[model samples]
Target chain A: MNNVYLRNSVRFILLILLQVLVLDNINFRGYLNPYIYIMFILLLPFETPDWFILVSSFLVGFGVDLFSNTMGMHTAASVFIGFCRPGVLRFISSTRDYEQGMTPSIRDLGISWFLKYSIIIVLLHHIVFFYLEVFSFHEFFYTFWRVIISTIFTVIFIVIGQYLFYKKK
Target chain B: MRQLFRFLFKYYFFFLFVLLEVFAFIMIANNNYYQGGRMLNTANQLTGSIYQSYNNIFDYFNLKETNRQLAAENALLHAQNENSYVKITNKLFKVQDTTYKQQYQYVDAKVISSSTGKRNNYLMLNKGFEQGVRNDMAVVSPIGIVGIVNGVSNNFCSVMSLLHSEMKITAKIKKNNYLGTVVWEGGSYKTGTLLDIPSHVVISKGDTVITSGHSLDFPEGIPIGTVSYFKINQGDNTYKINITFFTDYKKLDYVYIVRNLFKEEQLKMKGVQHE
Candidate 1:
C-alpha cells in the first residue's frame, strides 16, 4: 500500500510538470497539443477508493489548469472520466478479473486491452474538453477536427510513455 | 431517517462527482464571462514563480534571436536620433523639453509564457501591478501591437493576445484615412480581418493598416499589419479585408505595456460630452 502511494504521488507530480512545462509549450502548427497527464488517472490501482479517484482527478486536472490558464475545462473533463472509470473497467473486464495490485497499464494488461481502455477514456476527455474550450457549436466541424486529432496524438504519447517508463518494472 | 442515511452513505461518490462538476462548470462560466478571474490565472503567485523559473532555464536559447531584434530596433532609433541629423537651418532653434507633455509611458516586460493556438489566447508577462502594469493597457512589440493586459497580480500579469477571438482594434488605412475594426476570426495567428471599411474605398493589395487614436488603450498610428486580401461584402456595403500582422506572436519575447497618462482626463471629457 505504501509503495502504491509513493509511486502515484511521484507519477502525479512528474506528469503534471511534464505536461505544463513541455507538451503544452510545443505549438505544433497551432493545434496538436497532446495531454498525457490523463495516463496518471488511468494507471491508478483498480481498487483505489472511489472518492479518492474523484478528488485526485480533480487535483491533477486543476494542477494543469492553474499552469495553462484553462481554468475549468480540464477539471470538468477529468472528473467526468473519474466518474466513468469504474464502469469502463467493469465493461472491459467481463471475462477476466483484475488480480490484486493490477493497474490499467500496458504492463498489467496487454497492449490491446490497454489501448481499448485508453482510447475510450481519452476520447471522452477530449470531447468534453475541446467543446468546452470552443464553447460554441457554430464551428462544429472545426472543433470536432481538433478533438479527433488531439485525441489521436494524446493516445499515441500515452502509449509511448507507458512502454518507456514501465520497461524495468 | 435511518433509510435516508443509508441511501446517502451508499451513494456519496455520485454526489461528490455532481458537486465537483457543478463547481467546475461555475469556474468555466465565470472565466468565460468575467475575463478576470484573478485567483485561477497563471499570473498568480505559485504558477507565476514556476513559469519564471522555467523561463530562467530556457531563456538562454532565445538570446541570439532576441539580440538580433534589439540590434535592428537600435539601428532604427539611431537613424532617428537628433544628433544623427545636421542642423540644416541653424537659426537659434532652441529645443525645449517642456514644449511637449508626455501622453504615454511604456514599461518594458519579458513574455514568460504565451500561447497562440487556443481560441482565446493569452500571454503572461513577468511584470505586474508592483511594476505599474494595469489591466487594459496595450502591449506592443517593436514590430507591432501584441495584446492587451487582462489580469494583473503582484509580480505578473496575463495579456489577452491580439489573436484572441474577443480582441478588437480600431484600425485605419494609412493612405486614404479609412477607419475599420481589426479582429481575429479563429484562423491563422498571422492574419486578422479588417471590418467597417466601405466597399468603394479603392483599397488595393499592400495597403498599410494602422491603429486609430480612438481607444485610450493604444496611441494612434501604431503599425498593425498590411492588407493581404480584400473583397467587397455584397450583403453589407463593407469591405472584407484580410491583413497579415507584423508582429509574429509565436516568436514574441519582449513587449512594451503602454500606460495612457491622459486616461483620466479622456474619461472626464467623455463624461462631460455625455451630459
Candidate 2:
C-alpha cells in the first residue's frame, strides 16, 4: 500500500517533467497543444484520502504552472477537475457496485464508461484552462473554437497515453 | 455532538474540495501580480536548448528558401541605396551628412520554438541574457515586427508574439500619419485590428501602417501591416480597421532583437518629469 503511494509520486514527478520539458514545446499547427499531465489526477488509486487527492492535484497543477509560466490557469483547471472527480466516478460507477480498493480503469469501468468519463473531465479541464487563459468573453465565439479544438487534441493524447502505459495486462 | 462529528467526518472530502478550489481561484485571480514568468525562464532555457538541437536538424530543409529570401532582400536594399545616392548627388555636389540616423543595433537570433495559432502565442529565441537579450526588447523579422521579449534566461528568451491577444503595438498610417493601437483579435495569425482611429482620419484599403515610435521599444517607420478593411462603428466615431500583417508569423525563423541604447536614460527622464 505504501509502495503504491511511492509509485504514484514517482509517476507524478516524471509526468510533470515530461510535460514541461518536452510536450509543452510540441505545438502541432499551434492549435493542438496536448496536455497529458492531467493523467496523474485521472489515475489516482480508489479509496485514497480525499485530502491527499485535493492537495496532490493542486500541487501537480501548481508545479506545471510554475514551469509553464501560466501562473494559475493549470492550477485552477486541475483543481476544478479534482473537485468533480468523485461525483463523476460515482455517477458512472455506483458506489454499491464499485469493488473495494479497485482503482478506476477501462477494464473496471468498461470502455464506454471510461470514454465518457475521460471526455467529460478533459472537456471541463480544457474549457476552464483556455477560458482562464484569455480571461474574457469579449471574443466568446473565438474562445469557443479554441476550446473545441484543444479539447479534441487533449483527448486524443490522453487516450493514446492511457493505452500505451496504463492498460491492464 | 458525537452524531454531528460523525456526519462531518463522513463528508470531510467535500470540505477539502471546496477549500482547495477556493485557493485555486485566488491564485488565478492574482496570477498577474506574481512574477511567475521569471521562474519559468529556467525551464525556457532548458527547452530552448533542446529546440535548438531539433531546429538544426530541420533547418537544412528550408535552407534554399531562406537563402532566396535573403538574396532578394539584399537586392532591394542595394537598389534603394543606389536610388538615394543618385538623388543626393543630383541635388548637391558635396552633401553634408547632418541628419542624425537612428542609432539602432540588432542581434540576430534563431527562433527555437514558436506558436502562431493560439490565443496567447509566444516565441522562444535562441539568444538570451548572455547575448544581451532582455525583457521588453522588440523582436522583428526581415519583414516586420514580431513581438517583445517577455522573459529571459541565460541562453534563451521568450517573446509575447504579435499574434497574442495581449499584444498591443503603436502604429500609424504611412500616408496620413494617423496613429492608432494595433492588436490581435484572437483568431488569425495573419491579421490584426487597429483601434481608436477617429472617423475623420481618411483610411483606405492597402494603406500601409508603420510603427508610430510613441514607445521606446520599436523605432519609427518599422512596417507593421496594411489596412485590409475599415468601417465606422454604428454609434461610435472610431473606425475599426482590419490589417493584414506583412510578416507570415507562422513561418518565422531568424529574427532581429532591437536593443535601445538610450532606453534607461529616456525612461529615467520620463519618470522624473512625471514625478
Candidate 3:
C-alpha cells in the first residue's frame, strides 16, 4: 500500500512537470498539442475509490490549468473522464474481468486493451477541452479537426510513455 | 430518514461529479472576460516564480538569438538618436520640444512563458504592477505589435497575444491611410486578417499595414504587417485582406510594454462626450 502511494505521488508531480515544462511548449504546427498527463488518471489502481479518482482528476486538471492558464477547461474535461472511467473499464472488461491490484497500464493489460481504453477517454477529454477552449460553434469543423489531431497525438505519446516507463515483467 | 440516508450513500459519487462539473463551468464562464479571477493564472505569485525559475534555467540557451535582436534594435535606435543628425534646423528645435510632450513611455520586460498553439494565446512577462505595467497597455516587439496586458500581479503580468482569436488591432494602409481592423482567424501565428477596408481602395500585395492610433493602446505609425493576399467574396464591399504579421511570436523573448501617458485623460474626455 505504501509503495503504491509513493509511486503514484511521484508520477503525479513528474507528469505535471513533463506536461507544463516540455509538452505544452511543443508547437507542432499549432494543432497537435498532445496531452499525456491524462495517463496519470488512466494508470491508477483498479480498487482506488471512485470519489478519490474524481478528486485526484480535479487536482491534476487544476494543476495543468494553472500552468497553462486554461482556467477550468481541463478541470471539466478531467472530471468528465474521471466520471466515465469506471463505465469505460466495465464496458471493456465484459470479455474478462480485472483481477485484484491490477492497473490500466499496457504492462498490466495487453497493449490492445490499453489502447482502446485510452483512446475512448482521451477522445472524450479532448472533445470537452478543445470545445470549451474555443467556446463557439462558429468554427465547429475547425475545432473538431483540432480535437481529432490532438487526440491522435496524445494517444501516441501515452503509448510511448507506457512502453518507456512501465516495462513488462 | 433511514431511506434518505441510504439514497444519499448510494448516489454520492454522482452528486460529487455534478458538483465538480458545475464548479468548473462557473470558472470557465468567469474566465471568458478580459479580467477574470486573478488567483488561478500564471500572473499569480507561485506560478509566476516557478515560470521565472524555469525561464532562468532555459534562458541561457537563447542568448545568441536574443543578442542579435537586441543589437539590431540598438542600431535602429542609434540611427534615430539626436546625435545621428546634424543641426539641420536650429530654428525649429525649441518648437519641436514644446509641441511633443512625451505621450508614450515604454518599459522593457522579458517573456517568461507564452503559448501560441492555443486558440486564445497569452504571454507572461517578468515585469508586473511593480514595474508600472497595467491592464490595457500595449505590448510590442522589436519587429511589430505583440499584444496588450490584461492581468497583472505584483511581479508578473500576462499579455493577450496578437494570435488570440478575440484580439482586434486597429490598422491602416500606410500608402493611402485607409483604416481597418486586424484579427487572427485561429490557424497560423504568422498571419492575420484585415477587415473593414473597401474593395475599391486599390490594395497591392505588399502594402504596409500600420497602427492608426485610433485607440489609446498603441501609438500611430507602428508597423503591423504587410499585405500577403486579398479577395472579395462576390457580393461584399470589403476586401478580405490577409497580411503576414511582422512579429514572429514564437521567437519573442523581449518586449516593450507601451503605456499611453494620456490614456486616463482621453478616457475622461470620451466619458464627458457621452453626456
Candidate 4:
C-alpha cells in the first residue's frame, strides 16, 4: 500500500527473475560464481522489522533453491545472515544512528561503514552457503577458497548494485 | 506459562530464525539422500516453463553450433542407414535379416537449464512425460553420455549429471576391461574420479573409459572419458583414477534421452524372481 512496500515488492520479483534467469547462467570456471540475489536481502531498510527480515530471507532462499536445485542451502545461509544482521548493524553504527526509511547504502552510511557492513554479512553468508553445500569439512581448503572467492564476487555485485539502484539521502 | 510466554515474546525473531534454519536443515538432510525434493525442484511445470521461455531467447545465440552438431550427426546417421546397406554374397542365401534388434530408442530434448558449479550438478530438460521421458532415463549428448533422469514433470525433467557428488556411474577401462565407479568431488566440473578398479590391472594414460551397461540408465560402451592420471592407494588394493569426461557440461545444449522399450518387462521379471 505504501511506497517502500511497493518498491520492496517490485525488487523481490526483479531480483528473483534476474537471479534464476540471468545470473544463474554465469558459469565462472565452474566455480566462484557470484550470487547477486542476496543483495535483495542486503538492501532492505535499516529499520525493517527483524521478523520480516528473517522470514523474507527464508522465503527468498527457498525461491532460489527452487531454480538452482540447492535444496535449502540458500535459505539456511540467508536466514543465518538475517540473524546476524542486527548485531552487525549495531556493531557498525555504534556511533551514528540510522534514520528511519533509510537503506544501508554507501550514500546513507558512508563508504567505510557500508564496506564493513557488506563484507561481514557477505562473508558470513558465503561461509554458511559453501559449508552447507558440501556438508563436510573434509575438503576444507576447497570449500574455503570457494567461500572467499564467491564472497568477494558477491560483495562486488552487491556494492555495484546498491550504487546503481539506490541513491544518496 | 507466563514466564515462558514472556521469553518467547522477547526473542520471537531469534526463535523464528531457528525454526526456519531447522526447516532448511531438514530439507538439506532429505536432499542428502536425494539430490532434490519432488515438491521443490525446478523440474516442475511452472519453473520449467520459466526456464524454457528464457532458453527460447538464449538458444538463438548458440543456433549455429547446434545446427553444425546436428548436421554432423545427421551425416553420421545417413552413412549408417539401412538404405546404405550393401547386398553381399554369402555362402548361404541370407545375411540381411535381424542383424541388430533395436535395443534403445532416443527422444530428443533441449537443456533448458544446467549448472556446473555445485557439489551436485543438475540439468533441466525441456522434454518430460509428454515426450516419454520417464525417471532413470539415460540422457546423452552427441559427444557422450550426460546424466540420468532423476525427476520428471509434465513438460520437463531433472537430470543428475555425472558431475554430481551423489552420482556413481559404472564405467570400465576399454583396454584393460577393469570396471570402476565414477564419483565427482566438489569444485571442478572438468574432471571426476573413477573408483574400485583393482591395482593389479595394468592401465595407461589416455585409456578410454565407457559405460559398463550394469545399470538400465545407459547402454554398454558409451564414452565416459579417458584416464587422466591414477595412483594406487598404499593401504588398499584399488586404484583411484581421474577421468576427463567427454561431454563439456558448460556448452551442453541438445541431448537425447534413451528410452528402453524392454525395461519394464525386465524389471517385472526380476521382481518376480526375487519374489
The candidate scoring highest on TM-score is 3
- How does candidate 2 fare on TM-score? 0.79
How would you order the candidates by lDDT, starting with the best? 3, 1, 4, 2
Model 4 stretches astray by more than 4 angstroms: A167-169, B29-32, B35-40, B82-100, B200-202, B235-237, B268-275
User: Could you say which candidate leads in DockQ?
Assistant: 3
> Which candidate's lDDT is highest?
3
**TM-score per candidate, in order?**
0.93, 0.79, 0.95, 0.90
Q: Pick out the ten consecutive residues of candidate 4 chain B with the lowest summed lDDT.
A: B32-41
Higher-lDDT candidate among 1 and 3? 3
**2 against 4, candidate with superior lDDT:** 4
lDDT, candidates in the order shown: 0.89, 0.80, 0.90, 0.84
What is candidate 4's lDDT per residue for B1-275, written digit by digit as tens? 99999999999987998999999998877654553335335577878888888889989999999999999889988999989988686567855566767879999999999988877788999888888878888999988889988888888888988878778889898986778998887666878888999999999989999999877768888898889999998899999898898888988999999988778888898899899
lDDT of 4 by residue, A14-130 (tens): 888888787777758767778887777888898799999999999888888888888789999999998999998888773467667778778777777888888999999989998
| Per-model root-mean-square deviation over C-alphas | 2.5, 4.4, 2.1, 2.8
Question: True interface contacts reproduced by each model, as a fraction?
Answer: 0.62, 0.43, 0.67, 0.75
lDDT of 1 by residue, B122-143 (tens): 8899999999988888999988
| lDDT per residue (tens digit) for residues B158-271 in model 2 | 888888777789999999998899998766677899998999988889999999998898988889999998999877899989999998887788889999888998999999
Q: How good is the docking of model 1, by CAPRI class?
A: medium
Per-residue lDDT, model 4, residue B122, is 87
TM-score-wise, the better of 2 and 3 is 3
DockQ (CA atoms), all models:
0.63, 0.37, 0.74, 0.67
